[model samples]
Target: MNNKPLAERIRPEKLEDVFGQEHILGRGRILNRILKSGRITNMIFYGPPGVGKTTVANIIANMTNKRFYKLNATNASVKDVKNIIDELDTLFSVDGVLLYLDEIQNFNKKQQQSLLEFIETGKITLIASTTENPYHYIYKAILSRSTIFEFKLLNKSNIIDGLKRAIKIVESELKDKNIKIDEEALEYIANVSNGDLRKALNALEIAIFSTNLDERGIIHIDLNTAYDCTQKKILNFDKFGDNYYDILSAFQKSIRGSDPDAAIHYLARLIKAGDLISICRRLLVTASEDIGLAYPNAISIVKACVDTALQVGLPEARIPLAEATLLLSTAPKSNSVIKAIDAALYDIETKDIGDIPAYLKDAHYFGASKLGRGIGYKYPHDYDNNYIKQQYLPDNIKDVKYYIPGKNKLEEKIKSYINRLKGSEL
Candidate 1:
């Protein structure tokens, strides 16, 4: 009401006032334990936007009774980092200075490295906030020195509670007019904001200012008004961050788990984030790793879809991507090929594999038949069904069964054929 945005005006002043991230902020949680210890360390707070990273840092600074120095890493340089350390060194206090760096991922290697000495020496307690994953964005040396706490997106109930608080603050600020919002309107805002409290509050503030007051000075907000106030919801997805990998993991797992609907949902998330290459690459991996041999042609279809997506590049790319996602999700699933290769590699690394059989050795080279290379190797093309009983593996691992076909139709056929050739059940 005093020209400050609702989000800024209602920022939580204490840990109790903060919402969500209960896994980290609830009693007996890591953060709570750290706060209760009366000593704070250099730490990184990472999460999506509008999830109280900065607010939580401020609360920690206040709760620990430390002098807080805030800097936006986007504009701050290595010199600024060094200067903050210099300034903190001069401060004579038992509670140390808390240097809260926002968008800490923007600090390149040099800038982040500049703070290591100070953090290590206890001259400054670094509280870095980033929307990106610290492990990928921050310097490993700094990561090794700091504790990392991950924040999560606020749920619908959390957003609703925050919106209700915002409404109360607005009504109190505008004492001359009564501002009223329906429950459904709040819920709509919560739903559209996609668990972002800042966006939801901003939308609520817009709705409040845009609506007309009645004769009794009551400004009523409905679902329609809320929808109009908040147009298209902006998704918070950092292509280079944890959300990107998280979505990709979920998408692949959904397809592997044979949940086309969930696969589509995660695919839509990736598409919304405008990550075409990741989608294509993940689809290819899923096709080969999750839907291998069971449907040998699935990889070709996925590859075609990927090529189409790469050529078309979004909007239309989503069509082929969707097709590929559904295809992989519905295709006969098998990890036999991947498992077979992994098992072979594991044995190669962990076991003493004997030399290749003389019959299976490379006889095409200048070695000739003098060494008996390829002497006993039978040409399967001359036999019935183009098959023959022979030891294809090394002498030590001749009986190893690495390729275990799955129970899908195609794999069942393969199992039958292999069983017939081997004259035993596979």
Candidate 2:
């Protein structure tokens, strides 16, 4: 049996063999243009894991036909970087060197700074790969010297293509073993891997290796076998890192955007990361801030879901959480309540505001009536239709309107009712 992993065994050697990231690697793309020029410069590949950052870096070095040296920033010391630079200098060739650094974000300020002179002098062409936002993690000095190419997660189609290629390679190696994989099994692996081609390939390898051939001397991988092999989908979420906030942002935005599918997807990610508190808190906020008066009952539903989730944690909690996510995502969207409150608070903080009107003050307090606190206060209940228009705001801001109803059906009804009441008072 070959000890090498399937992903490593079938790693793409040429740009054409690369399955995903067509946006950058496709014909007439920026990477293609750079490769054709045969003149490489310092560049950073920024993206999620298993998205071919290291693969692309290797391809660049191979295509350029330069002296290739690789270093993992995690364990490589500043001395190691200097040693590579010194070695490249001895080559004394015009080709220059291609230094592929993996996890460049791990390099500290001192280590990163050490590479400046070498890169600046054009003696070392840096091809760095990082699973982080380079702007936030990498030093500005290094970023300024290198062009950044963002690699996005492979889409479903791209992942499926990669899985097919892996399957073919495995079958070829097995030869007379007569291994066969159902199309649905391939799709299941693709879907569960969530756009990580390396993960999909690994899952395929596991399913094929773990399953025993039937009496017919043929190994048939079915959907159930695939699910059993790749039961736990690897979630790219860090509970204490930027991904935490990123997933939360995506969840709330999906609900606000009225996309239940996206909201549930993000919710699943949070659940998989065991972040129940964030899910409940964000859902509650979305209910009030996004749904608001558009669906006054949404807050209650979300609160119930949160309470239920807190009471019964984990697997069961997912049910209520899913309910709340779907409810808030489909509910009529509105931010009128938040907008009104923010507008009122802005005026109170920035502008000189008057006190409460005398008629609206507490008349039951001692000596309050003597000070004319309750004077001229018209009781609406005593008027015709039990309605009256009285000044609620202070004398200075009586004309100000803050609580404008939203465009949803419920808010529109409230708006009509308010208009009718005001007209009757007139």
Best-matching candidate per lDDT: 1
lDDT of each: 0.88, 0.87
Output the lDDT of residue 119, model 1.
79
Model 1 TM-score (2 dp):
0.89
The list of candidate 1 runs beyond 4 A from truth reads 89-95, 300-320, 348-358, 361-367, 370-373
Clashing pairs counted in every model: 0, 0
lDDT by residue for model 1 (250-337), tens: 9999999999999999999999989888888899888889989989999999899999899988789999999999999999899998
Give the per-residue lDDT digits (tens) of candidate 2, residues 147-224. 999898898898888877877788789887877789898888988897788888888888889989999988889999
Candidate 2 TM-score to native: 0.78
TM-score of each prediction: 0.89, 0.78
Output the lDDT of residue 252, model 1: 95
lDDT of model number 1 = 0.88
